[model samples]
Target: MIVGVTGGIGSGKSTVVNFFLELGNIAFYHADIEAKNIINSSVKVKTKIEAFFGKEAYKDNVLNKKYISNIVFHNPESLKQLNAIVHPEVKKHFKNFVNQHKNKEYILYENAILFETKSHHTCDFIISVYCDLKTRISRIKNRDNISENAILDRINNQWKEDKKLLQSNYLITNFAQIETKNQVNHIHNILTKKRKLI
Candidate 1:
């Protein structure tokens, strides 16, 4: 089984994925990290990004994230172009990952843009992690040292939480006030049982 886990910025999706990892049977593929790696390592991706964004897109063969982020967040067309270049490669990488983990009962494909990139179609189940907007803003502010407006811009760029919830097979609320571990364990047990019947 392939479970696609997603959440908006600062929704604690990584923490939830960690809890799922603690259960000891699931293989995990983090798409965001893989996307970064692909952009840095894949010649096709590098050429396309540079062609679109110019040489400033990278610094000494490494991605200039600040440069890229500035362009994408403020310009929807640029963001769409960037996604167009990167997502297909990320999807290919994910398929290779899933194939390698086929022996596992299930695997977790954690992505921030699962729905936007249409990767959810590859999932047997989708788990969305949600949290209040205020909490999300505060967490990102502290973690990314980003301004409130910038964080809000990034958040606004993604699908809204309520809309994402409608598409989810399961929802994990990751508010600080709630015990997320129990929720993860509950879902983990359910997934394990479901995998057996497959």
Candidate 2:
């Protein structure tokens, strides 16, 4: 089974993915991390990004993430262009990852923009991690060291959590660690049983 996990910025999606990891049977593919790797290592991606954003898109062959982020967050078109260039390659990489882990009962594909990119269509099930707006803003403020307004801008760029919630097969409330774990355990048990029937 392929499970897609997603949530907005600072919603503790990583924590939930980690809990899934701790269950010991799941293979995990973090799309954000893999996207960064593809952006840096794939010559085709690097060339396209350079063409779109100019030479400064990279510094000594490494991605100028801050420079890119500033441009994309403020300009929706530029962000869309960037995603257009990167997401397809990320999807290809994800396919290969799934092939490698085909023996696992299930694998987790975690992406912050799973729904926005329509990547969840590739999954057998989807999970959304949700937390209140106040908590999300505070968490991002502490974690990313960015201004609240800037964080809000990033958050606003993604689909609202309520919309994602309606589409998800499972929802995990992340405000409390204990509750989160319990929910993960319940989902894991359910998926394991489903996998057996498959």
lDDT of each: 0.92, 0.93
* Tens digits of lDDT, candidate 2, 1-198: 899999999999999999989996789999999999999999999999999999999998999988998999999899999999999999999999999998897999999999888899999999999999999999998888999889988998899989999999999999889999999999999999988888
lDDT of 1 at 125: 98
lDDT of 1 by residue, 65-113 (tens): 9999999999989999999999999988888888899888799999998
Q: In candidate 1, which residue ranges exceed 4 Å CA deviation? A: none
TM-score for each candidate, following the candidate numbering: 0.97, 0.97
**Candidate 2: which pairs clash?**
none
Angstrom error of the Cα, residue 147, model 1: value is 0.6
Lowest-sum lDDT 10-residue window in model 1: 175-184
**Candidate 2 lDDT:** 0.93
Evaluate model 1: give its lDDT.
0.92
